[model samples]
Target: MARFTTSTLSKYLLQAQVAAQALHTETAPVPPEVHVPLRKQLKDEAKKQKAAGKKKKKNANNQVVDGWELTVGIEIHAQLNTAKKLFSAATTSFNDDPNTRVAFFDLAIPGSQPIFQKETLIPALRAALALNCQVQTVSRFDRKHYFHWDQPSGYQITQYYEPFARDGSITLQARDGIAAEDGDGVMIGIKQVQVEQDTAKTLAQPGGVHWLDFNRVGAPLIEIITLPEIHHPATAAALVRKVQILLSAVDSCVSGMEAGGLRADVNVSVRRGDDPSAPLGQRTEIKNLSSFKAVEDAIIAERDRQIAVLETGGVIEGETRGWSIGSTETRRLRGKEGEVDYRYMPDPDLAPLVIGDDLVSHLRESMGQLPDVEVDVLIKEFELTPKDALSLTALDGGMRVEYFWNVADALAARLGLDRIENLACFQLAANWILHELGRLTSERSEAASEELGFTEDGQCERLPVEQLADILFYLHTRKITAKIAKELLWVVFRGTIPEKYPSVLGAIEEENLWFDELSETEYAELADEAVEGQEDVVRQFVDYKQYPQGKLMFLVGRMIRLGPEERIDPKNAERVMRAALPEKYVPALKASD
Candidate 1:
């Protein structure tokens, strides 16, 4: 049998088309009888599938049943956030018209040579250092030859033999969406990280015609390979998310799975038994999973598929497959390609990439703080709850984290205290930013996009940091009650720029929303006035003793209504009301108090 690779398949299709066209010129027309049976067979199969869809179907058990063990390793190709193509000076763009961003070198025009872009190395180095990988002093590129419409050059330039970095690791914390069975945390090893060129996108139209978009060709990419250390499907998903977070934190890659900034290729295999020495089953590679959920579901579906094949005394083919979200199954794409099929060779155009230790040190110093480190600082130094820390850091690619820090620091400055000395301010800032403003922003972001505006990354600009700090400052200083402060927050959230009024304090003063700074004597007078009118409520409290606390609260509400303009603090009103209560109605106080 002829071995059919991608290159061979394209040639075969072309040759067969030529032969068919020539034969059609010389041969007589076929009879209708030749086509009727095939049409009938397809229609019958469609009817059967349609009928089966109407019945309630049990979800296939994806659990690795009894004695099976599964392992998964992920390969991620993340497009670096750079302005130009890896080898050409053609600008990179996601929304540009197709074929417009291509350079002569990108299109493999005659005599066009590859020129390495030194700017690409800074981000690549930051990523390697963030992942704890050892940077190699020298790395070289290789040409992996294959034929597909996506590759105009007919080969991909990659770092296969000497990747720039290796032996990194990332820990999957239990709190970071890993399953409990995976233990507190699992440290997964990074096999290597390499720089590569991306191929053009292939969009398949009807009738087997594939359109090539070269806007993506020769764009810089970093391929992160991991050892097959994952045992469960959820863990694999968590690992991918960890990589996304780390890459985004360092400003190396946006890692936006939906926008094609990041794509994962998962290799999954299963075997029977718990022995470490057991021979592994033939593994199938699932290509181009675009979402975290797809990463998990594809692994489970592939694992179950392999187990089924093995249990039926059948062989699992080592092939490439595509994931079907609709059926939740893996569909075969092609048999796997091995090293010989790729025909890897050193690129004749580019020389070895050499880096000095000083450059690596500079990148390491210039790297932004990672998310985990920021999470720890939020929890320890800032005294935020662990839950709030994670939520704050995870929002909008850590833009919220920056907003929170600014608010917290400004509050401390206004209060004339160190942040550590005023834990209440940090806690208050976290509560409002994470819960109140966080929710308000999320709910109104779409409707108020123009009013709220957005950062360069498209995150809704959080309520300005100074305005939030002013509100917190007033509440801290007892100038405004929490209730009035919340009202102030809502006012500022709905496009009310408190800074225009000079500050939140200025807004409060200008709007007459400040809490009444009344004395205890004034509160007692109001409480007395409250009891004089509501005789029935007072009777229930003093004589009938029916729901005494509720009746007393009713009196407090009455007193508050009388002074609505005062913005009366509810706690002070309730306290003064209890004190002004008729002695007969006074509940016995605890001796301990």
Candidate 2:
């Protein structure tokens, strides 16, 4: 082999350095990702599992390694998507310039005390109810002392000891857990859900000094703490993702990981599988896991690190660690803080929150339909399977769900809601929105198109909700075949005038796009046209009394292009075809012998 020249070697060195950096950023896989293009695959799989009312069997990588079991509990810091801060009137809008969204209370000026905003309780109660938590009739605020770049007050207001709610649970699928053997799947325990104020953001400076952006200071937060119910990284990631979706569904928070709408701190520990209920070993906290994929990776790396340490007769340390993307391992950041170090105490400035039954009832009544409840209603009223219903109402199925309701309303205007005839319309709408539209929109390749890139949000925005309903209406009425529906949809997707409904109708008529309204006589003409070159088949039919069913259908399919938008009656077309043949070819009934 030829050796590299000095110039080529220099180029090689740069590439090698870059390759090493890329390796450092990604850690060992928990299960070699279930599929590639990480985020979307996990999301799609989660939807499939949720709809099926089941969890996947634990992946082999998810199980214990070297007799060691992983115990994980994730703490979700969900920032409330409210108009103002938790306790201040300053706007929480992300549109403002840096450091502009701040108040006197945020600065921690002397004699400044927080006065509560009553509206914050709306989302708080909604989220608690959604989580199946027991909302406390009364909850108190407390002070947590800590020093950081953002907390100018030297302490944070929170619900430390007696949080706003407790004793809630969310279902998950763990490798080995109490619920797994019971045939109920794994149920992760919720220790508490507390309302608190967030500290300011920090920026790096030229020297050792830090820059504090107080805009985020005193922001409202709901900390959901789990009770060591999760046992695998994938399970933990799925559960946290579900929580984020639930928060968004209820309008409790934005749940955007990059913008810090939601953040998770996953605590990982290990114990021997021989005694599953044994006290867990010392734990390490993987702090601020921003994405679901990151959560899965961090847990696997940290667990492997712990297992390797213990396998060598070394003890696992209880400390805080950060997963470095450039290093692909959990780096020691700082020692973990025990609860006693925070010096939690009651806050005298704010009055204790008293949530009465009337308020709870009002809030519950005002709330929109939750995903689970919506799924049930669709199953019964719409004649959908549990899986179909669950998928339609899933938190990630935002566009589909919204389209379903609005499409129903549009169809109801055309076909009365209570009429039995409208059932066809309802089913058609759901099928298109849930299945066909997704396939069509996702295949669009134009970079500038609305449906160009498939997003992790899992909602397709190819066409306006109303326009889609219109397309479904045509399909429901048998005006178009499933294939032709895509043509009309593409037109709508590309059309500049979204509001001009007549223009959509004009395009269909002008292009002769849909064969839906074609009469029986017209279809026979198409069938006649299809059989034009088949003189041999015609001669055979004239001699033998039989025209092959498969041959006839193949001809019809070729002639009409069998689209979704067409109102095609096959029996009628076949009848016309039989009549078109001469009397000599007509089959004669045999006389009784």
Candidate 3:
């Protein structure tokens, strides 16, 4: 029942050991009912002790809550995709050969020097600009002292006091039914965004010793903190996903939860608004939420835990907690650390980042259509639904939206139609990408026998986007049936272009053009051969035409199936079957015919 910090938990465990000696001698292991009541008493005592400790540290000037308002904020760390470290020339690649990428400056040896990499700084600026932040012309870095084996520097060089940007806002659309609407629209807000440096990774070992990998040290990192505008766990998850998309759109940040490029620190606090003077309860910070689902789960569990504490007239302590994904519970790590003087000052070794007028103009000019702009354009120009546009532009990989539109435009041209100009093509493209191409690629990636690099060009065993798009478009235009198109697409992806048409179309044309290449006599002979192959069905159809409509269609189906390499007109086969039927059977076959 007691809310304790990691340090406090250790103390309590030590105290409990001393107290247990006396209690064990005075009491005996008893019946279940007695033990239950005794445990409850001990829990109540613990809760009292926890509340008394928290009350001593309460700040009187902090905001008071009545009961209904819940405050939520997020700290997002997005890794920048720069070739070098922010403050050092060390390579900023992930999962590299351990400490090999570390430069002397990164290692922080005595008399070691530091040099700011413009490559990293520019991308960080671009990201801040994309986030709608006011870029600071002069920013400074400071040494944040922390003890960790991986941090050979004994401190992390990061921008804390004067960040590259501040007061930025990102607009995100909440899922329907998540947020309350004002008249007709829902509202979201952003707090701020700051730039920082990433820490080294700690690889776990069996005996609690971790192998330090400094490859990630000094990597440029941007932290985008949001206002507690989010009302639900689901909404928080959604906002994180939207931020990922926005970061990815700028091409400065590599945003992926699985790849450790994006991570979130979720802060959850609960309040009761019914009482006007009720205190705003303590908040718990859930650290390192790597995935969106983990963010949601941690928030939900923290919220519930805080609510229970308040209901029992207890207090929640402000502390950092770790989320256990396997158990879906939050364990207190440490109490909030007091703010330290970072001793922030401009680096004498590196020049201040000055944003000239011309550079700003060029950057603005080079900025392509951003995700939000693309979403709006897709809806207005292409007449797509908001949901559809969002999905098309929200992917984390490749030029999905552009590629989709390009292929859609190409198909429209082939059909002698104008560009989408309406929602029809947008809807069609969404369905094709999500249901067919996306599904196929995901499945194939999972099934690969070896390392199948998605970004590799002309990989012998990889699928091509062009080939997939062509097949889908062909099927969309009714140039091939669903079944035939699927088969042909598989063949094309496997690096084999069927010899029907010159390519996919040629293969499709081969099916229909088989009859064109043959003489009339030859075509007639082929039809006779098809009939002879299904003599049993033919005799039954000749005897009882009405009873074998399905059988007749099956027989015609087989004729096409058998001569897949040879073109046969499905319409002509039906005509020939009707003509070959006996006179007595013809009258009864009218309905099926």
Candidate 4:
């Protein structure tokens, strides 16, 4: 029946911890920086008596079926990909040796003072604007007092009392199979976005030793907190991914969870009772979830765990839990602390941050086309389906936007902007990019990352927009079939263009010619060869009229693949093949149409 929210439950524990501090010789008034280990150890030992190793309740796996209202909120810490740290001149480079990238101010050395970096505000402003947040005219820095192994300065410089932006919203695009949970047009409210400095990296050794690396000490970070409106795990994951893409587009963060630069903290609570307006249950905080998928899984695991506790007549304890990848369960990390425990105060070293109309307007005009704008253009103007448009932008973020832009540019060049404004040309370009280029390019990216040592973001190094444009233009103008377009995109990505595809000049006759430059005569020859030897199909087509249009397409498509990689325009080939199917068999094409 004991609950953490009631101070009476933890009174003696706090008293004992305070009394025990005097026995240690680690210096009384211990800077709060050196006493983190003892506090962590105390929190650990206390959880052992509270059923630490108990498995999740198998009987109450269905939270919804068992009548529970689950509420979830997400907190994302995005490490801005900036040139320098937020409050120091230290370079924000990852993978550097431990303690090497630290600036003098990062260590709080003598005569050191925090110098605010104005350039670091660009990405933060861009991200805030993209999310529809109201940028504050003035914000301030607050020192968050804490004692952790990773934080050597005994506190973190953050936006505690006031943040850069607030009261924003993100409109979830229609269910496009990517994240079906956050359905169409659902607008998730943004609480606030705060710019802060990251802590150092803590490396755990084998024998209970922890080494602190100061390389990440002063790195700039932005925390995007959402209002507690999420009810499903899939929706939570969707919001996380959308924010990640938005950050990547604005150069706010690399958004890579594996690199430890981007992480998420999920807060979940479940309500079950006869009353609909009962006070919200005590929320458990899940710490440091990295992947988007992991966010979904951890939310579901913790939600069920909360329900399991409630159904068993057990009070839900307000605490922090860590998601375990190996066990697929949430393990207790430590007792949760209220806002008062952090002792937030105005930081003396730094002054209040102020932005004017000119600064806000500069960042506003500097932002490129956002996802919503791109989707509207792709759908309303280009006449693409909502699914295809969302797929192009959401799946790969900035790179996909760039790729589609190149496709549009190539189309405009080939057909002129006025002519390419029609639905057919735009739809062709969209479909080819989403279905064909999307699949093959992903494979190429993986290969490049493994073989060429390219960064995850740099996997598109070989994908020159001009070269990709060449392939897309062919499909847009009906100059080549989708099959030929795919082949051209793959070959062009791998090597030089305007040359024979095969390595041996004469070993396999001549190499395949590029689709864009193929002659019309070549298309006719390929079509003639397709229906040349099929007599039975020809009889059925002319005399009996047995097969349907679907059957005809299947046979013709298969026949097209038998020949060399010539510039055989599929539309031209289909027309010519039907034209040569004798005058009587023409009704199969016309009537079907």
TM-scores vs. true structure, each candidate: 0.76, 0.69, 0.70, 0.72
* Model 4 per-residue lDDT tens digits across residues 1-593: 22333243235323323433433434323221332332344346446534567443332233243477778888899998789999988898666655557666675544668899998998898889989999999999999999875665788999978998999988776542224434464778999999998987665444454455667888999999999887777778778877877777677785566556689999999897466699888998999987776787788788877888878999888899998542346999888565338889999878889988798898788877787687787777777777777777765545665666665666677667663456687576667656665555344464433321122332345555555655666555555556666666666556655355433112122544334533567655665566565554655665444545664665468546865545455565566666656563455455654
Q: Please report the TM-score between candidate 3 and the true structure.
A: 0.70
Instruction: Kindly report which residue stretches of model 4 are placed more than 4 angstroms away from their true locations once superposed.
Output: 1-66, 176-183, 256-259, 337-340, 394-399, 417-420, 431-447, 450-466, 475-484, 498-593
Query: Which residue window of length 10 is worst by lDDT in model 1?
Result: 29-38
| Model 2: per-residue Cα lDDT at residue 461 | 55
Among these predicted structures, which one has the highest lDDT?
1
Task: In angstroms, give how far residue 535 of model 1 lies from its true place.
Answer: 17
Task: Between candidates 1 and 3, name the one with more favorable TM-score.
Answer: 1
What's the lDDT for residue 36 in model 3?
28
Tell me the TM-score of model 2.
0.69
lDDT of the candidates, in the order given: 0.77, 0.69, 0.63, 0.68
Residue lDDT tens for model 2, 154-199: 9999999889899998764332122233244567789999999988
Which candidate, 3 or 4, has the higher lDDT? 4
- Each model's total of backbone clashes: 0, 18, 13, 0
